[model samples]
Target chain A: MDVIRPGSLQDCLRILKTEHTIPIAGGTDLMVNLALNKISPDRIIDITGLQELKEISLSDNFLKIGALVTFSRLAGKEIAQYPCCNALREAAEKMGSPQIRNRATIGGNLVTGSSAGDGSVAILALDAQVELTGLDGIRKVPLSLFYSGYHQTAIHSDELLTAVYIPIRPGTSSFQKVGKRNALAIAVASLAIYSYIRDSHFEQIYIAIGSVAPTPIRAVKTDLFLQGQKITSGVIKEAARIIQDEIAPITDIRGTADYRRKLIANLLADQLQQLSESKN
Target chain B: MLSCKINGEEIHSEIPSDMRLIDFLREEMNLTGVKEGCSEGECGACTVLFNGDPVNSCIMLAIQAEGAEITTIEGIAKDGKLSDLQQAFIDHGAVQCGFCTPGMILAAQALLDKNPHPAEAEIRHAISGNLCRCTGYQAIVDAILAVSQRK
Candidate 1:
């Protein structure tokens, strides 16, 4: 095995163009797999040294988070104070444990494409765009479109995810997850909701559900049903029903299919109710 | 070969690119203080200070630690005297079975380093990763809190 530590992003991109390299950020996920011999690549690209990809900046109505930004950074007070970043911050805080969060990067979590990944669910709700850089060029793909299948992403083998861009807007967001244990446990079902409201009506709403589908997915049907609708117990109950029908949950070691579906609905309804109550 | 500052010592050694940092530390460098409870990232028994931040060494590659500053449990004491935090642990009877002490101490140290006066909730959140099947966590939390109060 060979490891190449690229000093600059350009050097890393150049290496990716020619070598069959696997780019590792914090090595929280990849290193575990490598240790178990689950994955073996000819060359490994250590991109952690590339300071260019470790930034978190907000500019031009967009919050740009570099791929190397760790979960610990996202959970910091500076990022958590923003309303637009509430769901992301909550997800980051709830993920893994302190040690794992210190080393796990948002890019690694999204690139893993796990339906139960807390970051994936929150980012999907935020309707974020992922910036993929390759030898060809740079392309921004919506988070919803980035996942091709389970544990797979639209990112080409040679392409590296550089940054995630989220449109910053004044919205109330909530993230909720039900796991077997409070700390260091995978979510049985998770939900994230972000809404822009005017008066008592929702101007726009984005809902993402995780651990109930093959990938972290936006509840488009439910969102459309609730958009521009007044916040009421009736509307919220109906929306919960729609969400239950929208998600395709499966039974796993963490939970049963029926249990996950019900959990998602309850979580969504509870979040919407809280958002409504907080608005008034 | 990789060159890294381990426990304040700048050392160079031929380490495999795929070897986990915990394995390299225990096998190559003979630092068994970093225990391996769960090879997966779920257990924080292998926690270490990577560049002043606590991280699980079991899930990090040795190559990834190249040029990084790491502080293990052995590095906590100086001149054969235990640090205030370690001494507090013993005084508070925080050690039980002693399996999780190293990682727990390191995690608590990381917290106290950043916030000298962390609230009870903050201290609990800081060591949420480190699991101790023995102490039920009351004494460990008390030990860390005592250190914070002393300072």
Candidate 2:
């Protein structure tokens, strides 16, 4: 139950590597896990107070989101710049409740690597990259490769996730999801679709779905099929079928795998129709 | 050891390292307004404003609150005068059993402080964390909105 408040990232890594430490950002997830007796670490590194880790900036090619940036901060009008990211914004807006969003962080959500994490699916759809800092220095990794499996991440105990980078995409995006209820609810099945249109045809399509797989997964088969294809009911149905086949949903308290598959098909078709209608 | 400001008073207590903020406020400070509905983060009954941000005190460690300013329901009124928001809650009949009111008030206060002119949707979003089984939340939202609409 040791609580260590390191003044800098370097010091944090030093103390973390020297002991059985867990970095706590917002403590939205870590606190709950600790209370449930699920995780026991000798030292808890409090990173929530680190000012350097709380910044939100944008570069020429990418948007950099600090590891400690709360969902409430990201939901601000300033950071929500792109259309696909709009879905991410909407998801952020619906995460937990206002209190939860104020404390729960983007880094915590990504680090938890839960398939049901609403923000995880949204960021995954944006093709975000994560920055890691340690004794060696800073290095970045694509977010897709960050999570190795359920409740697991490539992030080591000696490293700290500093920022998340999202490259700007050209297109309008929408997120449609079905949860048990409205607020503080995990998605039974959710879909994020970002498609760029060129002369009524999809030049590029980015689709990811969550709560239906071990991790938030992109509908790669559907994405490839939709690319360069005209928006039509037939194309949407075909892509929907491809998504149902691609994702490996499991039976959880939320819903059954068969139900989730059906949900994916319906949500994909609905969002694609919405994209088509919004075009005019 | 935890040292921080709670309810406008500087606190320095050698509490158990694993004591959560909710327990610290209730047992040490005797500020029982922060009720614990769910020990987990799902229920917002134990919500408190830490550094002007609404968070679940139940899920956070007491030591994690060190060096931070916390606002509880007891801190809402000054000089024995109930805040307009608190009065509005009474006026709108927002409390039934009165367990969730303190947290509800703090959550509403945090929202009003940030956005004084929040829309209806925003009002709902602000108190989404605080669960109210008695009022069904319409009265709660009305109370917050009524107070916010006042000047």
Alpha carbon lDDT of each predicted model: 0.90, 0.86
Q: How far out, in Å, is residue A108 in model 2?
A: 0.8
Tens-place lDDT per residue, model 2, A1-280, is 7787788887888887876788988788888888778999988888877888788777886888899988988777856666657877877877887778888889999999988788888888788899988898888999778878888888987888889998876876667779888888889998887778989999888888889878888888888889899889899889889889998898988899999999999999998898889887
Q: Which candidate is the best by lDDT?
A: 1
Task: List ranges where model 1 is wrong by over 4 Å.
Answer: A18-20
Candidate 1 residue-wise lDDT, A1-280, digit = tens: 8888887888888888765578888887787788789898888898888787889888998999999999999988757767977999999999999999999999999998999999999999998999999877999999989988889899988889999999989887879999998789899999999899997888999999899888898999999999999989999899999989988899888889999989998998899889888987
lDDT of residue A113 for candidate 2 = 91
What TM-score would each prediction reach against the true structure?
A: 0.97, 0.95
Interface RMSD in angstroms for candidate 2? 1.3
| lDDT for model 1 | 0.90
In candidate 2, stretches whose alpha carbon ends up further than 4 angstroms from where it belongs are B1-3
Fraction of native contacts, model 2: 0.78
- TM-score for chain B of each model, two decimals: 0.98, 0.98
